[model samples]
Structures are given as C-alpha cells and as structure tokens.
Target: MAASPTDTAPPEQGGTPGAAAGFPSLEEMQHWTWVIGRMQQMMMEQGLAALPEVPGVNDAATIERLHDFWSDSLTLWQRFLTPGGAAEPGAPPADKRFRAEAWREPAFDLVRQSYQTIADHLLRGIDALDGVEPAQKEKIRFATRALVEAMSPANFPWTNPEVIERTIETRGENLMKGLQHMLADIARGQLTHTDGGAFQVGRDLATTPGQVVKRTPLYELIQYAPVTDTVADTPLVIFPPWINRFYILDLTPEKSFIRWATQQGLTVFMVSWRSADASMKDVSWDDYVRAQIDAIETVRDLLGVKAVHTIGYCVAGTTLAATLALLAARGEADRVASATFFTAQVDFAEAGELKHFVDDEQLAMIAALSPEGFLDGRYMAATFNLLRGRDLIWNYVTNNYLLGKDYAPFDLLHWNGDITNLPAKWHLSYLTDLYRDNLLVKPGAISVDGTPIDLSRVATPSYVQAGREDHIAPAESVWKVTQHFAGPVRFVLAGSGHIAGVVNPPAAGKYQYWTNDAPAESLADFVAGATETKGSWWPDWQAWLAQRGGGQVPATGARVPGEGALPALEPAPGRYVTQR
Candidate 1:
C-alpha cells in the first residue's frame, strides 16, 4: 500500500507533509535556496565540512532500492494513465496535505502521488552517496531535501488544484494580491509573516500591564504590576533573548506567560533588550552580562531584596548560565535565588542543525554585509527558517504568494516577525565562545566580565525545560544541562517545539509534559522513568518555584514598578521593543 503523507508527518527534508507545504514566495526564496547550496559547496571546499566515515556501498541493497523505485513508479504511471477511466490514485486517507475534495480527482491526485514518489526516490538516492564524507554527506542530504520541498507539486500554481480553482473563481484577483505581497516582501527584504495592522506591541499583544522601571543602553527593565493581592517574596525577573522582542512571553492576555505568572501571585520583571544599531555594533558579550547584572541589581534595589528568582529563555538562558558562572566566580552567586532555563543549552556538542550556518565563512559574509557592526535580526531569522524550511519558509510561499491569501492575524506570528538586531561583536562572541568551543559548560575554560568562567561554579538551584521536538536546541543537548549544574537540578520534558513549548500557558490547555525526580544516566534514561501528565507544565513549575519563593507578602503592600528605588521610565512593553 502507498503510504499516506500526513500534514503532521515529521519532516526530515523538503517540508512537513502538511496541509500547507509549497514552493517559494514567487521567485524570492528560490534565490535564497540557491545561495544556501552555493555557500555549503564553498564551505565544504574549505575543508570545514563535518564528514562521517565512508560506508562501503552495498551492491545488493542499492539494486533492491532501485528495483523498488522503478516498481512503484510503474504502478503510479499505470494507475494515472488509464484510458478514459475515472481512476483514483490510492485514497489519500491519512494525508491531510491533499485531502481536499478537489484533490480526490484524477489530475490533482496524480500530481500529489507523482511528487511524493519522486521526493522519496530522490531522498533515497542521497543514501547512495557513500563516497562523500559523513559531514558533507549530511549537508548534501539537507540541500537535496530542501530542493525536494521547494519543488513540491503543492507549491506550484499550475500543478496545485486549489490554486487553479481559486484563480478561476476570483477571475485573477488573487494573482494580483499575491503579486503585491511578493513586491512588498521584496522591498522589505524579508518575508511577511503576518498582517502588520493586526497586533500593535502594547495594544493587542504584550498586553500584560507593567512599567519600564529602568532604561539602559543595552536593555529596558520592565517590572510588571502584581495581578494578585499578594505575591511571592522573591521577585522573578525574565531575561528574554535579544534576537527578537521580549513580548513572546507577554503575547495576548490569554496566551501571555507574563500575565499568567503575575496571576499566579509571582512578581515578574522582564528584560527588554535594545535593538542593535550602528552605535551598538561594537558591544561584546561581557557588555551584555554587565547589563544583566545591572538589571539584577536594579531589581534587588527596587524591592529591597537580597536576591531574586530568574528565568532565561533561549539565548538569554545561555547568557544567564554564563552570568551565574560569573556571579559564582565573584562569590555573589547567592544573588540569584533560583535559575530556570527554558529550552536553553549550556553545551552545544549536540546543538542540532544550527551549526551548519554558524561557521567562520558565514560570519565573514555577514560582517561584510553589516560593516556597521550589527547582525540584522533577519539574518538570524532566515537561518532559523532554513532549519524548518518547509513549514516556516515554503508553506507561506504557497499560501501567500501562490494562493494570494491576505496575511493572517496571528499574535504569535506577529511576535515572530518582529526581528531585532544584535551587535556583530556580540554575535561573533556568542557563536564562537558558546557554540564553537562549547566552552560555557567546560570548567574554567572561558572568561566573562573579566572572570574565568566555569559552569561547575554555578550552584544556583536550577530548573530546566526543553521541548522533545525542539530542532533549535535538541533535547539531547538540553539534557546535558543536568550534568553541569552543581545545585539540585530538575529537568522537565514538554511536548512540541521551542517557542510553543516555552510560551505555553495553562489556560489554553494544549499539549502535555513529563517529569521524573529520580536520577538517570542520560536523557533517554530520564524519559524511561518519567511520568507523563496532560496539559501545560506551568503549574508544575509554579509549584516548584513556590517552594523557593521566600514565602508570601500582602497584596496591599506589593511594591509597584515606579514606587521603588528606581523611577518608571515609561509604560510596560516600552520603546526598545517597538524598534524594528
């Protein structure tokens, strides 16, 4: 039986066999695709390609695969070319990507089967390239997968049945709209992910009430008002990644993690990192750590507290780990009451596919383009999109460019498109010190803020959360977090990928989580003993946080943002996040 390609099928290449997979944004993304292949080839020539050992080709297996490929192709050809017969290619029962009533017919159904057959054969052929080094071989496989995805029948307007129907129905109005979208995205030099007017930073999204208590050159410190009558004594400060705005946590009021935390009786503060510009081109990692310490101190002074609970998401969590090491080196580790890492990796030995784009060659190219000293957030965004090209890159290409659909009004996607620039020095430092050396986890290997850094010194109580399907920071890498912390470490596995897994709130009641308090030898071992539970992981984490929250204080006496040692600079969300 022919296997059905479901929309949710875990994609290894091209794209998720989903309801929306496709080609490109007209011709724009194809150019990017070519550039990626070109860069990979150039980099491989430089002898920097990671290669696996050459495997001796199995003649018997190769012949068998070819025989199967031809057998399947012949069957599909016979089924589709039946004369005057209303032949239905095998029922696409499980494949959500092509279940439309329009797709159940002859020609449309043939296109779907033909594409899948060819995609499967092309992918299988890559396995025969045993002569290539394993590293470069993998690169070849990825590039091939990308090409396969880009060439999907669903991506092309001529081959896609729905697109044909839409064109006939709308009398080519959709084509004009699609052309407009393409021109706009081309002018902006970035793909449009959402309707710009759908959600403003402070109004429709990031609606959690708060105040910018302190504004630094590096970041704006936001202290949220307590939603409850009383709050945990140890205030919580969140250090969000600088690649984008900090509003992911404070998205819609219903989906907002910050608002939910405040409602849970926890005083929350957020670090809104300033968007990079020519003036910030020379800022280093040490400057970021210094800025973090300054924020920590600012929060400490505001509430007359000795230490505060801290949470870091993604890049911010990696930096927070570094900051913890620095504080430990300075004998001020106690200043952080507890540190929580959300999909953050201290060790990058198994850092997933991102390593492919972080080489010296890529950095050199970026530096040449960004002589002003900062890496555009779009570069980082594009790199990440490459990792999930089918879903993030091509799905919209098919929908927005070919189908001519108006941009959707999604708050999360709105946040996703809000890119932030980073100093090139900081980018080079982070990609080198953390990713290249994997030094953040090694003892006394790297120095930060003029102090020799060591992860072993970071004895702060730690809680680590990782998505099981996270491609950005693989769970295997996040699992390594348990080994480096000296304090009692608790690692929890959540369903879904990086952003959705971390930004998940309890109210919506989507996905599930797993936990195991017992010690385990590895990530796999931990999962073997872990107990799975339904719904969000927020409450479980909140329960753990309450134990170290330094008791509770009355709502009547809750410290407001501007009422503390520092004065309020502006309303919540702040101006820094408003920057492009």
Candidate 2:
C-alpha cells in the first residue's frame, strides 16, 4: 500500500485494501444449491405420485389364489387359441405384450411394492379392529370379507366369443329386422336408389305445422293459430328452447301444452327461435335477450295489455331468468307479471352425467368444430344420444335396423330428429360459463350488457317443475334453483324425463310434486323437512296460476289480425326454422 494503491488492491475485491467484496460466500452458494435441489426433488415426487399405479404380484396366500385364478384364465385362453378348437385357426393374439426391456424390472419392483402395501394396510386394519368394540369389529370384518370376495377375479363372467356368435345367429332375423328398421328411418327422406324399392320418403308423416308470419333480420315470428279472440288481460307468451322447434309445446291436441294453455282461456304468443345461418354468426346471448324483450313489448303494445305472463321451457328458462335479472337491474319488472320454468337449469352443481359432455375437453372440441359460431345439428344429436345411449342410440340400432320394421310415425321423435343448430358464441359461453364453471349460481359470475345476472333479483313469482326420471335435467339439479330466486317459488318434481315431464297433459295419470306452504329458509332444509304428495303437479300448478292470475279477468273483446296483405308476407316456417 505504501508502494502503490493498485498493487495493494485485494484480489477478491478488485480494489484497494478497503474495498468491499461483491461475490457470494461459498457457504451461501451451497445453501442455495441445496434449496433448489430439495425443491426439484419435491416436484419429482409429486409428479410420480400423480401417476396411476400398476397392479402386480400378491402376498403368499393371495398369490396362490391369483395363480389358481390365472391358471383357469390361461386354460380358457389356450382353448380359444388352439387351432383345432371351435375358434378360427388364424386369429389375432388376445394378449397385450409389455416392452420386455423397459417394463420387466419396473414390473417386478411394482409387484414387490404392491405386496408390501397390502401387508401394511392389512396390519393397520387389524390393529384398528383391535381397538374397536366387538360388534363394530364383527361388522368391519364382514365388510372387509365382502370387499375381498367382490375383488376376486372369479366373480367376472367369462365371455365366450363362439357362444356369443351362436346366440346372435339364433336371433339373427329379429336383429336384422331391427337394424333394417333403424337404417330405413335414417335413410328415409335423405337417400334414394334407382329401384322403386329404395326411394326416399323423408318424414312424410311427421311434418311440422305453422308458417313464419314475419321475418326480421334476426328472427321470424311463426304464428300457428287462427287469430281468434285475443284475451288481452290474460295474454300468454311461450319461450321454447332454441335447441328445438316451437312444435314441442304444440306437439298434438292431446299432448300439447300450448293447446292446453290456450284452452284454459288464455291468448298464447309463442316464440319460435329462428335457425341461424352464416348471416347470424356474430349473434350473442345479449341479442337473444333483446329479441325476447322486444317480443314481450310487441305483444303488449299490439294487444294493448299492461303486462303478460311468460312460460319458459328447458334452456329457455335460463334465458328468461337472464331477461328478468336484466329487467330488475334496469327497474323494468313491470313488463312481466309472472314466470314459469319447465325443468330449467338455474343451478348446475348437481347436473349429473350431462356434465361429462360439457367438460373442458369436449367444449374445446365443439369450439374447434364450430369456429363459424354455430354447433352442427348432427353433433348436437350425437351428444344427446350419448347421454342415453341405450335408449336413443342402441334401442334404435336394435329395433329399426336389426328388426327391419317400420318405425312408428311419432311427432315427438320427428321433433327430436329435427334438432336446431346453436349459435357458436352462445353455445360455448353456456358450456364454459354455466355448465362447467357454474357461474350462474356464483354471485356476479355472469353478466349481460355489463350488468351482472343477480338471480336473487328475479322477484317475479316462479313455478319451477322437475321430472322424477329426467336423465337430462335431474330433479335434484332443478331443485337447486329454489334458493337462487328471491320470489315466491313453487318447486314441483314431476313424473317423467325431460320431454314427457313438460309435455304432461292432465289425462297422463297420477303425478306428484313437493311445495312449501311457506317459503323455506334454504333449498336443502326445505327438502329435508318436506313431505311428498301423490297426484299430478298439473292441477296444483293450475290452482297456483289461477290464484296469481287474479281470478282471471273476463275475456277482452279484441280480435287477432288475419294472415294476408294486412300482415306482411313472410317466408314459410320463416328462414330461422331452416338455419341449422
């Protein structure tokens, strides 16, 4: 330092004697390295734990049992494999081989690990049994023994391919008839051959009635009735799901809900969702809500009514709820007097197996396929078929195609086949936000026009009905809606599935429902303390509506306009019916 400042600089500091060091100490570096290594180890362990374990070798007694079971299985397999046996001489190998080099050591280790795990679990269970009461111990022992018995491989049936073939051949004619019947139905109007025997007769008997009266850029208002006396005071508006045609409610004289309501001294105005084409690709949920609101206003102004009662079915109910929520937020509740929902999904927490089809993966696939902003009718039909494969898919496969019988001409089936295309934007939003995320029940989770859909704000007296055997919309899922509405709610559990439940006529037979004499504190509490009654919910609903409808004012003396130059010329069934 006395000679020169630069020469006196410390090597570590790269400066003169008093300069401070910048680099970390060896001990600190080691500590950081150890921390990073530990974190990586934890991540690796977690990754391994996430994987499903492979089944392997058993303990001594269990091994002996499994060996005997496998010996029998191997013997059966050998019999099938034999060249001279009933099975064909050259058949594909049934066994799936593992990679010997990659899997052998791991498989052996897994076997050892599995045996150890079983032994440990068995010991723990025995120890736990020792601490329990004698009766409880006996019950536990019985349960454990039953579980073990259930786990035995012998419990499974040995499916013999030859036997299966023989049985199928024995009933081949009936099966063939059923197959032919289904194929005939599928090909009916869609296919044709040169021969007269293979000509198409597409849905000749299942034609939908009602023509479009007026077509707007977005929708066509389809009128089905002879414009008779308009009951201005008790004007009714039907909100059918856009997924199907409006004819579902007006199916037939006997099974028609709209017809029944009209006969009940009410003027009905039904909304037929116009099938969307390329022009309507950008249509959103907001557009639907606006269209419906406009419809209600149009009906009121045209008929000179103060307000109207609205009935929504299935997905339409959700739309109705959204509209009501919007109205309530904007202080426009005076437009609607009351609302009725038929098997609507307000809360989707317990949506059941339908949830499987609307999961992230399926929805992504739908989005990819429907990039143009509408789900194809064929895809929708396929999804619905999967929900009840045995009924919708296999039943037809067995009956129509296999049996070669003519399918009975039914309006409901025809309507079911005539599926509507869903706008891609709305469909994706519904799947991701409502079904998957359950945003409807979650406060402030959904909104329209930047205004949140607060379900509690839906104060209009509501009548919600759910079917007992509804596979699509289960009773439990529908019942969840009671808590979401702040209004006087009547929750009715009906007697059939999605379609039959809503289409239920008075003469259908005894149906049942549950209602609160007084509003319950919560849906769960209400159900827990509720009593079940036997009878049709239809009469109960009729009584309820009559009470709220203010004893039905005398029929207004207004007449509906006739179809011609007086009403503007509209396309047949309008353009919407054929959009999808």
Candidate 3:
C-alpha cells in the first residue's frame, strides 16, 4: 500500500479516498503544482548551472544532517498515531509550522507530520547541495519557505480545526465575517487586523501633549510641550522611521519615550513623516534627510540653541546619520551636538532575516507591486510580519478569523497594524545602497544631498544600542557602527526585541542591559566583556545625554506655540499619523 498525498490513505487497487482523510483536493493539487512550477522558474533564473553536487561523500556534518532528517521522519510516524501536536522541543526558534489545532486531529496529524518530514528533508537537501552557492541557496531557501507556509494545514480553511469549530459554532457567520474582512482589505488596499476604534490617536495612543510646529511636504516637526520647569540647553530631536508612525515612541503616557524624556528635563522635538502616497512618488532619500535638516534648523532657531542632540530609531537612524554626514561635509556640523541610534544599522552586512528579501528577484517583485510610485504599507507590513509569522501573522489569523473575535485594545498591536506607505524611489534606493550595495560603510560609495555620505566623518559623540533578541537588526550588526564614528561610541545591548528595547522606561524596571565603553577587536569581544546591570537602558541613556549637555535653562525659553517661521501646523499625534 502507498500513502495518499496527505498521508491518510493506503493506496488500493481502485478506490477513491474521502476528503475527510486529509487528502489534497484537485484544486489544491493544481494550485500547489503551479506554485512549484513558479519556484522552478525562479530557481532557473537564480542560476542552477548544474545539479547540486552533494556535500561530503560521508563527512560527519553530512552524516549528522542525514541522521537528524531520518529521525524526524520516524518521529512523524509516531506523531500521526498519537498526534502529539506540539512543535518539536528542539525545533529552530523560527519554525512555527505545527501550531494549528487541526494538527491534533488524527487525520490532519498525519498531514502535518508528512509535510514537516518533507520540509526537513528538503532543507537538508539544500544544505547538502555542494555547488549551489549562497545566492542560489537564498532563493532556494525562500522558495522552500513559501511552499511550506502555503501548504500548512492552518492555511486551508477546511483543514483548520479552529476555523471549522467556529463555523459550527456560528453556523457560518465566521465565514461571512472572514469574507467581509478580506473584501474590506481589498477595498482599502491594505491589510488591517484591529478595529481602528481600538485606539484613538491623541486620545488613547499618541496622548502626549505637543504641537506640530513645522510642516514639510515630506514631514512635520513636532515640539512637545515641556514637562519640567527647567530644560536642557540642547534640545533632543528624534528622527523616527518614516515607514511607520512616530507614535510608537509615544504610545500612551505610561510607555511614552517622549513623555519620559520631557519629564526628565529634556526638551523634545520629533519628526512626524507624512504618509507618502502616489503623489509623492518622486520623493527621494535626500528629500527626507533635507527635511530633517530643515526641522533641526527650525527647532534650533526657535529654542535659540546652537545645536540639538539627535535620536534616530531604526531606519530613521540611518537617515539621521546620513543627514549629519551631509551637515559635516557642508561645514555646518555644529547643527547636531551628539547622536543616538536605537536598533538602527549604518552597516548592513550582518542585517538579519530582512536581508533575505533584498535579492534581485525579490526587489523586482517589490518594484512590480509599487508601480504607482509608492510601495503599499500593507505589503511592507505583510513582508515584515513574515519574518516572525507565528507571532505576527498566524496568531492573529486564529484570533480574528478562526475564533471570530475582535482584536483587543492592545496599543502595541494597534500600532503594529497601522501600516504606512513608502515612496518607491526612496525604498528602492535604500535596498540598493544600504542592503544590497552596503555603500554607507564603504565611505564615498554613495552621495547624499551632494555630499559623499561617510559615517567615518560623523564625529559627534554617539550612543549605539541594539535589542538582544532583535531579528531585524541583530545586536552584533548594530555593534559594527562603533567602528564607523570618529567620536566616542558607547554600545549597549538591551534585553528585548527592537521596539521594546527603546520603549523600556526606567520606571518599568523590566529588562537588563549590558554596556561596555571600551573598544574591542570585534563585536564578540565587546559582548563578552560587557557588564550586565538589571534595569532599563533608558536611565543609562539619560545619564549619558545629561553629561553631553552644555547647561540647563528655565523652560520658559522653550519654543511656545506659534513661535517662529515654523508655526504650529496642527496638534501632536497629527494628521499624517491618522492618514490610514
């Protein structure tokens, strides 16, 4: 007897199996056949010059890989009978393929087990492929991931037990709601999970007290109302990633970095980037940097300060670094006193899983999707979520579609769901120059605003931080920035992923941080010698910033509403944030 496609039936002389046994239906088979064909085409385009030469006739690593694959295959048999549906204990942290409730059903259990066995073997085969270099391997790895994720039992409405249970419970209302959500997504040209009502900008989410002092076609400069009687002579200006709302740093007063910074005697001004649409297609990276520069000049002039300290979070850090380089080249380097980067990368060589999507094929796909001159934020959200599919994608699927429940009012989740668009030219340039070309580290490889952007020339005292568990910007990758600057660099490793790393307030006193001021031969050495302290990194940051300041002055001198050429444009948590 031979196994059925879904591994439920033993082949008979001439017998048709029931669909309930977890066999692939004709439509599913056709869909997968087409997908496999497409993958083959991608493989060919990626240059599979010849059949992969298997690695090591019988090397230890090769043998061990084979043994593991065989053992997992055997385990699948056991799983089929008992349906020990939990994921394997030692499974790679990234693997989330077996969490579906359907995998617990005896029939679907076989389906999942068989798929996992095949996937494991497929990955092993790729690892064993001798001649297929890293470039080809990346494509193959991506293709395999696509096929595995697509074929998961959870992806199919019928095979998913949670979806089935919800159908029975609601007499098909779940299906109707799911359909409505899908259609609504298509109508809006975006993917959304939470009800927007779950969070109201200025009310629930971005409730910090501030006014938008200056507006640019490209961005808005926000001057947060002072919370202290006396403020630092040098104000702190934040350049948040334009890809998402700046409010992530200001989400609710309790977790608000803006509120915290203001209360700590630091005047705060943040760049609130307008959500770019097809109309802003011609916007370039230089335009964004120039806008930040304009904001800096506006803030400095209003506060009567010679310079402001800069905070760049994620991609915004990249832009701020480039802006400083531009200012340095123009001999106006005094515009910024010091710099801080939060989970941001100036060097991209070790940029993690997000790098998987920067190859020629993926970039072409992105370009095709952004023909309107801006990449849809929904697409960006979907791609980013794929890097952590279990937590960001499937979990929401179960809660929203399968369980037929409204999303709870989670501020973080709401902000995560509020997607933003990217200008086509700027994003493509970022991919080419930073991710693909890695020109920023090369010094003079790329020019920004007519200045050859070089991080080596960014001599301002700097604070560089990375999240220990950050998958996007690995801590080691962030550590490399220390070598790029001519000024003193203090590198800190905080205990959390990207967002939480920065949002951590000292009051929460949650995560520990490791700091090492001494330079090292390599990032490994830096981490090995760093001293770990139990508390938020924010206090360490504030203490560092406090030392860099010239002096403190009465808060009455801080820019009030309608103070200069950059008059109040709107309130804080401005229009751009609520564009969606």
Which tens-of-lDDT digit does each residue in 1-580 have in candidate 1?
3222221122123321322333332122223433443343344333222222224534766656655665666456444443433364565546555767777655556567768988999998888876788766777787898898888877888777778667766766788889999999999878888898988988898878888988878889898888777788899989999988899998888888898988899889999999999999779888888888988988887788899999999988999998999999899999999999999999998887876666789767877867888888888888888888888888888789888998889998888888988899888878887777788877878888678988886789999999999999999999998898888898999999999998888877899999999999899999999999988999999999998988788754327778766778899889899976
lDDT per prediction?
A: 0.80, 0.60, 0.76
Compose the digit string of candidate 3's lDDT tens values, residues 1-580: 2222343322122212444334444335334433443343344333322223345435766666655654555445433322243334443323455554445544454455566677768766776777888866866886677666656666666666566656655666777777776677679865566776877778898888888877667887788888777888999999999888999999888999989999998888988888888899999989988888888888788888899999999999988888888888888988889999999998898887788888888899999999989988988888888876756766666566656666566888788878889999999999988998888998788888777877788788899989999978898888888878887888889999988877898888898999886769787898789999997999899999989898988877445555555567788877777785
Candidate numbers sorted by lDDT from highest down: 1, 3, 2
Please tell me which model should have the higher TM-score, number 1 or number 3. 1
lDDT preference between candidates 1 and 3, better one: 1
Clashes of each: 8, 23, 0
- State model 2's lDDT: 0.60
Q: How many steric clashes does model 1 contain?
A: 8
Off by over 4 Å in 1: 1-65, 83-95, 556-558
